[model samples]
Target chain A: MNIILFEEKEISSTYHIQITDHRAKHIVKVLRSQVGDRVRVGVIDGGRGMAKIVAIKPKFPFSVDLDIQLETTLPEEKPVIDLVLALPRPIMLRRILSQVTSLGVGRIFLIDSQRVEKSFWQASLLQNEQYREHLLIGLEQAVATRLPEVSIYPKFKGFMDELLVKDLDDYSALIVADPAGTNTFSEALRQAGGSLRQGGRVLLCVGPEGGWVPAEVDQFSGCGFSICTIGERILKVDTAVIALHSRIMALREIL
Target chain B: MNIILFEEKEISSTYHIQITDHRAKHIVKVLRSQVGDRVRVGVIDGGRGMAKIVAIKPKFPFSVDLDIQLETTLPEEKPVIDLVLALPRPIMLRRILSQVTSLGVGRIFLIDSQRVEKSFWQASLLQNEQYREHLLIGLEQAVATRLPEVSIYPKFKGFMDELLVKDLDDYSALIVADPAGTNTFSEALRQAGGSLRQGGRVLLCVGPEGGWVPAEVDQFSGCGFSICTIGERILKVDTAVIALHSRIMALREIL
Candidate 1:
């Protein structure tokens, strides 16, 4: 991890905090850190912190001295691109999580769809924190300090009723990824004009293996989602997400 | 598999061929073919084939009325992009292969860099035939039928000695991806002239985790390569490949 993230509960004081969970074990075991070595650290939704290795006694537990109060908000320039995906197979889900996280999206919503196999939900990877580990690796690779909030909703109807229509607010553009959709991503991106530096929210939705049903398409359309495509090649859910995000970033001129 | 690929040695007669190997197992067991079922197949550099199940007797053997003909030819469009990637970990290799293939690139040269872990080469996934499986999946996802030729040199000096000093063959752009590189992808794309559809070979190079040393950058520039970036946000090797491909595609209007 480039910048270690800790919850508010982990911070015992303004400048000193004790790490005893994964971070501590990671620092002591995996990293094999020695005394006087400095490690990059941060807090979740807070600023960054640096931990100086004060003591290293393997197995017993190691200690570090924290001296940080970082204003580690995602740089104001990078726009938040949130994705709504109809969960693919387990293999696809792992890649999607890493790709979306690497793109620096603010969040990801794994929603259920008619074409999605029900057995996918029971995969061992999704049961434990296996999926979240992938996201952490993505975040670390990106050198970003924050991880996207990931939540799984069992059914699209419940997600629509409980999350989408009622809770989501001030979205600049709501895009549904349909291969045969009317508008092209280029046109949609050009139409949804905004400076990514201003923190505009763009939501991208991807369907399942068989693609979205007509009734589901109508529901997304009714929810004011703009349908778009990234050329004729039918990219998988993860590939499509990165391609779209890159194009949007280009249009926004954030890069 | 959209189009089954066979080696030159695998082709026997014009109308018939032996059914054995891993694919044979998948076709017989996983598919549970009975009779009169239509299946799509293709040859290595040949064309797509349709094999109708004419006879089957559990484990004993099976027969099919095979029609191996070119239903359609893959686009003659020469890939404008040539990818040079410092090899990634085994798990990420499949994603990289498929995504790069989906991007419709002309060549992918997975190389060794100073910081790249030597142990990566030992992974069983790197075996020639095994690696081909990942690329096939990518080809099917993007609906591009032509398979990319993969060549592995294993050692850094060997790779440079073989291909580095060779004539670049009127290649217009030489782009390199480094985390701390100069200029954003937009600036680089705009400067690279247009995409490959206009007949320009752009060599895009990407470094591994520890990134390129100064010596490597110096060598690249000496041979004609300019280091570039996607943005401040760090993207992993796989994500960077797609993002860079998307920009090049956009510049060429392929998006």
Candidate 2:
């Protein structure tokens, strides 16, 4: 973990925190931190700064006392990109969540598609808030504090219908990834006259392993989502998401 | 696997081939091909075409027979990007191999670095060409016929000295990835005047997890390598590789 993250409730009124969870274990073992040593730290959905290790109990049930110094102002969380992904297999879903969170996506919509196996929706990763661990892992990797929000939609048609009724004007462009796309990502962005730099968001839709069925593709197209390709190669869903997000972030000058 | 791959020796004089290995199993179980059905197929380091299923013995030790029709001309392997990576842990190494191959790299040089653990050099994945399986997996995913070549260097200084002796005139730009880089990737590309569109090769050097030592970074700088960053986020090595490769490919207009 690049940064040690703490929830708001963890910090005492005196700006002192005692961590005994995995974070404390990580600080003790992986970081090898000692008293008076300052480590990079951030508050969840809050500011980032450094924390001085005040005390260390290296015995069983390791604990660490930290004196926090958060930035006066919170970092603005204006993530310009969002994802509408067809739910992948559980293992892959975990990886994608962590990877994309590190890439700084604002929100994630795990929607259903024809090619997505029905069993994937039953995965424990999607139940309760089990997926939050992966998201936190991403946050820690990136050394950022903002946690991206995730929503689930088990019906493709239902999600599409909801999109029709929602306010999508905040999005400057809606892109759907497909191998058979007529235009490349840049071409599609130029054609759409996307204002990505002017505080506008882009919604990227990715398909399942076998890809979106014809009707699904048409649904996205009907919703004015530009169908685009990253290249000729058919990338795995995880690879595709990272590549697409990287390219988009590059275009936005964020990466 | 998106496309089935075969070796050159597998095809008979009559252009017929029989498979009894994992490919045959995939055909029978995963692909579920029937007699007279055609499947996309490619020859490793050769051509890509379709194969017509002639017969199938779906019993124990399942096998399949196919009549092959490959393209007469060989597809040119003109990969423009190469990687100089500090050896990562074995599990991440396997994923990187497959991921980078799918993204289309020319050559991979796994070298030693100050932060790289010494044991990574002895991984079984690097011995006897066992890493080929991961590369094949990548090629299969992309439906490509070419395989990337991999080299290993157990010594960092030795590898740097070797680079000095070898001719690197073919490379238009030599990049070294660093979080403390003075330029973003695109700015560096513009500064270097890289001839990516003219088929000039780009060599990207990535550091180990904890990053290159000052001397190592200086050595790369002395060798005319531009130190550049993908973004502010400190991504995991595997995520960084995929992200950096994706950005470079996008910049080259190849993706």
Candidate 3:
């Protein structure tokens, strides 16, 4: 576990972490961590700390005595890479959540695209916050302490013209994933370079499974957004996101 | 499978397919493929054909009668890109499979890296036909007919010496993945171009989880292998494979 997450109530007056919740079961039952075992712990929206187990109750509502100490604290200045993507099918949505969080993105703006399967948007996984849980699981795997804010945009043009570009004025770069566009990923990163310099507040756009219909692609292209291809192979959307970031990261000398 | 795989068989005048394995289960149970169902099929070491099923019986050794006609297939040559990689964990292996297939590589040489967990090699998923399953699945996704040949070399030195430089009378470009290497993926790809034009195989090596150690990097550099970085963020190996190919495929001008 990179950083074991906890809620505020888990912390005591002396800054000791009282193990509880699902993670508590994981530590005790699954991991079988005994007394004196070191367990990494961090408050969900709080500081990172590790606890040394001094005691345990290995049952429901389990508890563990804590001797907590802070380790590497994260920087408070969080940069967001909010993705505004057309909602994909349930299976693809599951993968996308993991990919976004694994890449350290901070927000998701799931928008409707003409090509997106109408039935896919209505999937139970999207309507409720179950996708949120999956994204959180990915974040946990990535050791990210922050969760990306997820918002759904049911309408396309209304979001693009009225809310997005206007409200996201601080964003230094905006990227859209389109197969037919001319610029390579390297070129896209060059355009996105401004975002890293200004801080990590950037916006990325990806289309649905069938891809943005010709009209939607035209609409996106008319904006200053550059289309970048990760490779000649037609990658699934989740693979594309990871592939896109990998290229961008390499160009920035951050591999 | 995007394209159902088949083995060559001399069937009855009706051209029956011996549906005795997983493919049979998939067709019968999953696809509910019945008599008169047409399916795309690729003959092993032969050509792709469409089969119209004539009959299906759940005999102890089940069989499906097929009327197959092979196509006038052009030989789509596999690029002489030999991948020398540290076997990534199972999770990473899935993406690597697809990425490698998409890159149009001819062969893969999986090696054990120092940083690679010993237990990873022990995973049953990497043994037997499991790895091939991953590759076939990936190839299907790309709608590509040819499957890359894979060779597993558990030891690093054997891979580097025998299968690598020893096979070369002419210069085979050697590029290794390194964060602080002599060049970037672009520079390295450029260097590989001259060798590629000379008509020898191109050998690209990607490191495992934490990457090749400094001494290993130095060893490759001494052997005239160019050390290159993908970028700043340490991407998972799966992402790196796709990203590396993204640039390489772009270098191919097929993008």
Q: Give the winner by DockQ.
A: 2
- Report how far residue B80 has shifted in candidate 2, in Å: 1.4
Q: What TM-score do all the candidates reach, one by one?
A: 0.85, 0.97, 0.72
Candidate 3 residues B1-255, lDDT tens each? Answer: 545666556444455555666666666766678888998776544577788877786544556666776683532466667677888887777668766775568778778878988877887767786877777666655555677878777777776687545554434567787767658666665666666665556678889877898877887787778887654444556656766755554443311
Indicate the docking level reached by candidate 3.
acceptable
Could you tell me how far off, in angstroms, the CA of residue B46 lies in candidate 2 after the best superposition?
A: 0.7
Clashes of 1: 2
Provide per-model DockQ scores: 0.57, 0.66, 0.23
lDDT for position B233 in model 1 = 65
Candidate 2 clashing pairs? A230-B255
How does residue A177 of candidate 3 score in lDDT?
Answer: 75
**Could you tell me which 10 consecutive residues in candidate 2 chain B have the lowest summed lDDT?**
B188-197
The digit string of per-residue lDDT tens for model 1 on A1-255 reads 555666667767556666666677777776778877878776554555467766555675555445455555343233368878897899888877877776787777788899989999888777766788778766666656566877788888988876665646756778888876988666666666653345667887888865888888889888878887667666877777788787776666632
TM-score per model for chain B alone? 0.79, 0.95, 0.81
Question: Candidate 3: global Cα-lDDT?
Answer: 0.68
**lDDT of all predictions, in order shown?**
0.71, 0.86, 0.68
The local lDDT score (0 to 100) that residue B62 gets in candidate 2 is 84
The regions of model 1 sitting more than 4 angstroms off are A28-32, A59-65, A69-79, A122-134, A161-164, A167-169, A194-199, B8-34, B49-51, B56-65, B73-76, B122-130, B155-164, B195-197
Order of the predicted models by DockQ, top scorer first:
2, 1, 3
